[model samples]
Structure formats: structure tokens, C-alpha cells
Target: METLKLKKLSFSARLFTRAVAALSVMIFMAACGNKGGDSAPPNTLLGITNCATCATSIPSATAIDVFSAKNATGLAQFANMQLIVSATMFTPGASSAYNLYTGPVAVQGQFIAGTTLVDPAATYGYGNSCTIPAGTYVMQSSTVGQMSLGMLQLPELISTTGVVIRMRVDQGMLYKDATTQQTRMYGSVYITSVNGVPCSSSFSDVFN
Candidate 1:
């Protein structure tokens, strides 16, 4: 009789252990499902540029698309997320290769210029600007003049019909000089659509 009782107890314990294990697995699966569902929210498609590989942070006024995203809970998640800048220009054709930045001009702000002070032993030039147009532009490099080693493309300027224009600088890349061997500097420009479209006017006037 004692033997039978011991056998029954052992069986019950084994069954209880199996049940606990099953329950644990179910809980784990539920947690995993919740985690998988929680992905970074989708962001609006913005222009991509290579960041200036320098010490200074690109100013915010040069940013293009500036917006925030929220989760289903209505909580703000990513704010002012900028586009990733590419190190090299986007080559569509063989002759389409262009420098990312040219000598800067006063598009919205002051007329900043591109610099040629690069680190020796590097092959590319550095010092880019953080200004771009709203429309898409083809990247090109200028073979003439002082500004000769960055990306260049003219964008179609539009009128900002009473909307707040925001800028966000994200990334940059710097080239090194072949002789001096110093790291060059680069910056990005992200232009985004405002209330209607971005114009050459001030942000306040854009909303007016």
C-alpha cells in the first residue's frame, strides 16, 4: 500500500512540474509577441546625405524634414528625426557622379563657403554646407573654380504658403587630404515640405 501511495505522489509531482513548464512557455511566448509588435514607428521619407566628419554639429536651421512620431498610446517617440547622409553621392549614371557639397551660398542664411583645409594622405576634399532645396536634385561636382570636391545639385525653389519651415541636420562625412593627411569636414542639408511647400521666405512669413 505504501509503495502505491509513493507511486501516486511521484506521478502527481511529475504532472505538476509539466504543467508549470507549459505555463512558463506560454508566458514567454506572450512576452515575445508583445515585444515583436513593438517596433520603431515608421518615419516620413526624408532626403539622405552624408554627415560632415568634423567637430561641429550641423545647425538645426539647415534640416529638411522635421517631425515627431507617436505610438498607439499617444506618447511621443522619435522627435526631430533626420535622414541619414550618405558618404558618397548617389550615382544614377556614369557621368552623374558629383560632389556632395559645393561652395556655400546664401540660400536662406548667410553665404557660408566650402573649405579645402583637409588632412594629408586623403584623396577627397571636405567642408560641406547644410542647405538644400525642397525638391529632389541630382548630385554633381564642379570641376572648375575653388569649390571643386563636394556634391552639388540645384533644387526647384517654391513658395511657402504660411507654414512653419523646420530644418534638421543629421549626419556628415569628412575626407582626408592626400598630402597633409588631415581629416576633412562635411555637413548635410535636409529640406522638407512645410504647411504647403517651402519657399525662400522666412519661417514666420511662411506661416503668414
Candidate 2:
């Protein structure tokens, strides 16, 4: 009777230990899973799921044309010119992980160059990468061109003034090992409108 009682107590102890171990594993997985929703607002209508790069705030926003650069001469003088940009997106990290990224997430956009400013004898080359500080900018275009980030494609973006996008831009140096550092820019983007419709209230379904 004594031996049987000892065996039963030992089996129960082992079972309890296994249960605790399984629970710990489950908790760890949940912690590492997609926790994007924690930072998002309640009942928010967002088109992108698991949006790791959602903009919390847009401090500085402006419309930029290729002609804005002093070196980009003849761009405004020419018609039907194309302006393309290869941009990477980063989620503004928390205090603990400032300036760090989960991985490389990038987007590309093609625009019909605007012909508003004409600098005949303008200087060449991007003078400084810091000319345009880290902020939100709208790449103004004459026509609605295609913009894509991974599988998400925004085919039609229409506006009278061609306010196609509002993207967060940050400057960095590429080819760190090279003698001269090259400027690289990347950031998150938000499509504020589509087909001349604002993305709010009644036209909100367009985003979905």
C-alpha cells in the first residue's frame, strides 16, 4: 500500500511540472507573435493588416517636385519626363529600439515629372543629403503613375495638383566602406486619396 501511494504522488508531481513547462512555452510564443494591434487605435479602419510601419504622426509634410533640387535642371523644361524613386519603409521604433528596423521593407514609385520651374544654368549633383530633412513629403506628379510596395499596388491615384503620396523620409549613407558616402532615403508612405476621392468618412471604403 505504501509503495503504491509513493508512485501515485510522484506521477502527479511530474504531470504538474510538464504542465508548467508547456504553459511557459505558449506564453513566450504569444509574446513574439504579431503585436501590432497593441499600438493601433481601437476601432481604427486600416487597409493594411499587421501594419508594422504605420505612421503615428506626420510632423513635417510638403509637396516636392524634381525641379525643387538646384541640380535637377532641364527637368522642368522637358515634357513627358519620368521621375522614379526607390524607397524603403521603416516603422518609427519605440524608445528602447530607436533607429532600428525589423527587416528591409521597400517601395517603388514612378511619376510624370512636373515642368513648373526652369533653371537654365543650375548647379549639378545633390548638394547635400540634409537639404530635405527627415519628414513627410508628397511627390507631386502630373499624371497618376503606379506605386508598389511588395504585393500591395496602388494603381490609380488622381488629384488636380497631383498630390499622390505623403511619405516619411529619412536620410542615410550607403556604401559605408567607400571613400565617399552616398545618400540613401527611405520611409513609410500613406495614400491620402484615390481617384480624386479623399480617404475619409463616405469614401473610406475605397481603401478597403
Enumerate clash totals for all models, in the order shown.
Answer: 42, 0
- Say which candidate scores most in TM-score: 2
lDDT of 1 at 43: 51
Question: What digit string (tens of lDDT, one per residue) describes model 2 on residues 1-208?
Answer: 0000111112257545643453443333334442332122123221222122322221121111111111122221111111222223333332111112222222222322233211111112312111112222233232222222211222222222233323221221111101111111211122334333333211110100
Clashing pairs in 2: none
Lowest summed lDDT window (length 10), candidate 2? 1-10
Off by over 4 Å in 2: 1-100, 104-162, 165-179, 185-208
Error of 1 at 148 (Å): 7.2
**What lDDT does the true structure give each of the candidates?**
0.24, 0.23
Which whole-number lDDT from 0 to 100 does residue 72 have in model 2?
26
**TM-score for every candidate vs. truth?**
0.16, 0.17
After superposition, candidate 1 runs with Cα above 4 Å error: 1-94, 105-159, 172-208
lDDT accuracy of residue 175 in candidate 2: 11
Model 1: per-residue Cα lDDT over 1-208, one tens digit each: 0000101012257545643453444334333332222212225432222223211222221322122222222211223232222223222222111222333311111111122111111212222221222222222111111122322222322222222333322222222222232222222233333333432221110000
